[model samples]
Target: MSFHQEPAVYADLVSLNVKNLKNSIEFYTKVIGFKVVNETEQEANLSADGKTTILQLRKADHDRTNNRYTGLYHLALLLPSREDLALITMHLASNRVPLGSADHHVSEALYLEDIDGNGIEIYVDRDADKWIWNGSNVHMVTERLDAEDLLKDQPDPKDFTGLPADTIMGHVHLHVNNIEEAEKFYIDGLGFQVVSKFSDQALFMSTESYHHHVAANVWNGTSASSPKDGTVGLNYYRLVFPNKEILDQTVLRLNELSYETKDMGAYIEVIDPAGNHIHLVSQNAQN
Candidate 1:
């Protein structure tokens, strides 16, 4: 099976509740280089390629996002190659966009924020063979990336228009109230395995031996609550499963925990402890 395809559980589309639909739409298209697939007065669907809707932006009831709240830390956009990352990096630099760059041993990443202070991470993963693994843990580190070398690897400087067709919503990092509780929900309940960890601060989980597909941290505070209804931040995101059997099993697990869920035919919708919604979709339904 393809590592990124069959039998691999991965994060698909992420929906965000933005303060300004128009402004957020423009920022995603203009700065982030996504194609607007569909748009209504209050909502817009965007894609890296014209065919797949990777992001959904909806206008929120409130104007401000509480940074201290337990919600999205960042939504990661994974590029297909290093060259693609360099091209986008150059594009952002040309526009004088302030960015934070990092080399995580397993991937090189560029971090920035939207107009509403929502965090975004654009990154390209290193080859799977190059990743370091010890037992069940995949080693990941945060260090300054060599931006100059990455820029030098691009095909051409002026070809930056938008993200490539293969770009995807790779992973999402969330701020949770507690690490143990987050792991219990995602790893025990959702069936993801712990792939990496950071003391009491963070935990990373994945399936099929890949790097983390979901990460959670308690950096904000152990008692942080979910974002209020009017606040801006994560609305929901799709967790694409390999098949109906897995999806059904996950739903059963959620029910066992007494968590609420809404069955939507092809997918089941559930909320995390922090109130972030998750749409669990079956692979057959995805097709």
Candidate 2:
């Protein structure tokens, strides 16, 4: 069966390099309520449900991730419902987990970081019909979330065991050195549409007109270089395209542009100009 067939193109999972495996795993499994799918000596895979892997934590020898490096800004986890989000909000509050809550017009999000300093966003999207759009650009705002209003409708008052089965990795935002270069790679090379843009600072791109699946910004300055290998930060993210033909065309386009890509049997891996690695996989390959 195809998982989350609506947003034809979306993120499958995010892999991160962390200094301490035990602490990071605990934070994700306990604080964030992600079930531990599998674990090994070097890495751990986590998800809301048992079948799908949403986040992966690989042990790293390097120190903490450098904020100056161009890498992950935040990995957004889309919950199944508003009650799930409210339950999480309650869990974070009772546990005293620091949160940065926001209402992005399109979604209600609560942000926090793991023990390894990788940013995490747990959120629930508003109705698709409710999302305002002006031509190609969708209107989004960063306003303080109304905590009282959000918590008022919580009918699920049970203990938080784990995230709902339908939870997914909503999107991944990266801190790149240049937004234009990012657009060239993501839009021109990978075949995503530019849904919204924030001047030259940030650009949100997606396929099938669902807000944004992937976003990038230059908040770290244009001179920011790629993170060193083995550093505690984003390793690579999986972008699952709708079908094989689209993936093939994307690979051909990138090759024609002289961008290097590695063929990993079922998928192709390409590194953007900003040194962020992306794995392009065919959605049909999931079965």
Candidate 3:
């Protein structure tokens, strides 16, 4: 009947558009510690540790149209194999990307951002049994992730290095206002299960049962937000449509829910209570 009316599980990632492709690539690979999956003059494919494609940076003009101060607050990239985390840990120390890392009881994460101010997080999932939940709130600690121990255990770079088959865009976060409304759109409206909720504070939801893959919270402490053209970041998010079937279904579902769909059916637009723009995109892999 509707696309997202059913649980629309996230299938794949296409790419992201940025003003500077080269700088973005360097930031992801060197600073954030991911491997370059592929690249072209316009866009570059990247991953956390060679497991799943994480991001594609595209060259776009800096203008009031897309510069909304979005600061794409670090899309999380889940390391495939456990060893994949070690390779990234070593690389982060070597390259130095602010080193703001944490070992949450639920997961271990490393955070970074691109040259264009898009955020990135490379992390590994802890077994589900280990997750500590407080009501709907998932208890994730803010403890420091021990980089030295993680690297020292692996020791030689030869043993744990380069691309692996386990890299994935684990989760994505957007700056928004009204955590409650956002939750309804993503969970009830979009059909993603609410794995955890900070309700009217922050959100963590997902398609499958593997914890949260998407989160949204208020920006700059604004109670309600309408991202201005001069804000200067967070262009658009690329959600891989499994095929035109799913894409068309998503369009119908969003439209029926009273959300705006645009670009002649190329994207879906739904505003959170704060008025931040969120787009569900459909594009060819080669696009």
Candidate 4:
């Protein structure tokens, strides 16, 4: 199936079922620097700034069975600046939340898992223009983080106080069994253009051209299959199209490719490489 080759989309936000809502919220605010924006009797929305809502927590048990339905590998959250990164690092260290930090040449990031074992990555981007590319493939590297230096220049925690919806979902990293298969499913099926590829090792795909909206690699797939049910993490991508015209075009495209699809209100869905569902959403003209 193919799409109208729509403009690339960055992720908006992802929701997760947390075993402990209050604990998760506290960890995010104290360790990750997110702030509460709104609450619907059953859920709490945490924002990076005041514009983007990073999380919608569904109160549930600390589920270890994330693999069956596919749990989260890590939701990479983008911070406004290096200072924001610095402030967050300090918060994590002070609170002593178990965490991991890395500097992927493309960006700097910190990794953590919620109570349910869903990984979360808080990160910041290096300027887009600064990205190094060779034949549309991005050059990324890993380096050690200088925590002491960052905390030395860290701002007061209050500096990041308030809602953080302004924060965008930088990108999502996933662990899949096959790169080529994933490529066929995500790119060919979903129509995301191949932005960069690490030879046959990994694939970074996007819609327009940022770096990579989705990076699927061979992390722990030694068995030649996904990690396992309750540990697969990241089942599908819910893509929302801008309008019905686009949605209809997508349906026609899927028909051309001979793939089965279901039409949802203002949206449509198709299965990707691993049979993970990708939903293409649009809005009703009158609504």
Candidate 5:
């Protein structure tokens, strides 16, 4: 079963504020290999498949801020295979785009920032059987990625056209002020299980045991503030549940925990303790 599909609550679309729509679009398309699904003067929707909108970039109303806010550490894009990752890595290198890479035991990831400095991660997971787990916690670590070995059998960089049609919005990592409160909101309120925890500093939560679908950390100081409105940063993210029953159950749980939710006809909206906006809806309900 696909962890991103039914029976698993996974992060889907993400919206971000960018200072310049044209520049952002160029960077995402030329450097990151995303296709423009649609666009307006102020906003553009990006897709890997040309049909499904996976990311939306909105021109910010104000100038970009350099503050370390409690939101959007990174949004990860999962590729179909390691070969795809290798090809993209070579593509970025050819374009002279600087990137950082790591092997996280469960996955190999390449990290870079958008023109507005929003973090982005492109990754491919290892086989599930190879993932190490100790009880409920998955053993994930940041280690040096063997780029030489990964690129040894890679196809030519000129063969790269764009991100694979099957690529997905894998997971989102956030910066939060309080770990306990964030845990209460994501775990207790939303019903995600703790797949891993890094002492009191970070937590990774997911459903169906497919590692983390959402992760939060207090790495930017415990008092990191939310970005100001119109700042170039995360606008919101969507979480897709398997079905309406589970979505309703999540609403009930959020209400029981005293968290406010706004009903938006097709989907419900909620804010995490650190001020990250979330839209919750069942897979079938999403447009």
Candidate 6:
């Protein structure tokens, strides 16, 4: 079964408020290897493929930077293979981009912040059959990634064009005020299962057994408030369901839990316990 297709609810796209549209466009295109699908003076749509947008950048109304606010922690982009990860890593290294990497047992990831301080992660998952599970929780460990070993047969820099079309918005990790409240909204309200937990500090939830689709942590302090109006941060992220029936069922569950949901014809808008905006839509309903 494909983890990103039907029968599994997965994160598809993320929209963010960037400080400068032109600068952000340059960073995404040159550094991240994204093509500008469409753009205006104030906003731009970025795509790995030339067609589908995986990320969007909107010019911020205000110049404020919400460094410690409760919003995006990092948006993880899943590459199709380890070779893709190596290629991007080499490309970034050649460009003198600062990088942090880790081997998370389940996956190997490279982390960096965009021009606006919005965190981004590029990773490739190990085979699901090889993932270690301890009862209900998946055993994920952070260790040093041997970049040298991975790049032994270094890919030609000339062959590195851009991110492959198959790259996906794998998952999103967010900052929330309270883990329990966030859990209630994501697990009980959205019908996701807890796949992993880091004591009481973080939680990873997924629809199927494919590790995490969404995760939340209190790294910004429990008193961290949501980003103030017009601050540069997450605008929203999309969660795609298999069909309308499942999407309607999720809405019913949220309503039963007394969470406010707005039906926007093509999609449903809901905010989590943190002030993070989420758009829930069926695969067939999305444009």
Q: lDDT tens digits, residues 1-287, model 5?
A: 47899988999899999888999999999889999999999899999999899899999877645566888999999999999999999999898888999999999999999888889999999988898989988999999999999999866999999999999999999989999999999999999999999999999999999889999999987978887766788989999999998899999999999999999997899999999999999987876
Q: Per-residue lDDT for 51-123 in model 2, tens only?
A: 7888889998687544788889999998888888899898888888999999999999999988877889889
Q: What is the lDDT of residue 281 in candidate 5?
A: 93
Winner on lDDT (2 vs 6) = 6
Kindly report which residue pairs in candidate 5 clash with one another. Answer: none
- Tens-place lDDT per residue, model 6, 39-137, is 999899989998899899999876655467898999999999999999999999889899999999999999999988889999999999999998878
Candidate 3 residue-wise lDDT, 1-287, digit = tens:
11221344552453455667787777666555568777789767776556445566666655334433333566777776556777766666565556568887778887766676566677887787777766556676579887776667664544445545556666678766567667767765565667666646667776645566677776545444455432335545555555567667766776787766575354555554455455564445312
lDDT of 4 by residue, 150-258 (tens): 6786567656454244466777666666777777766666667787777676778776566667776665452444333223234344555556676677767777767
Whole-model lDDT, model 4 = 0.63
Judge candidate 4 at residue 238 and give its lDDT.
52
Worst 10 residues of 2 by lDDT: 1-10
Error of 6 at 27 (Å): 0.5
Candidate 1 residues 17-61, lDDT tens each?
897899999999999999999899989999999878989999998
Candidate 6 lDDT at 147 equals 88
- Of 1 and 4, the candidate ahead on lDDT is 1
Question: What is the C-alpha local distance difference test score of each model?
Answer: 0.87, 0.86, 0.61, 0.63, 0.92, 0.91
lDDT of candidate 3 at residue 56, scale 0 to 100: 61
As a TM-score, model 3 comes out at 0.75
Clash pairs (backbone) in predicted model 1? none
Error of 2 at 281 (Å): 0.8
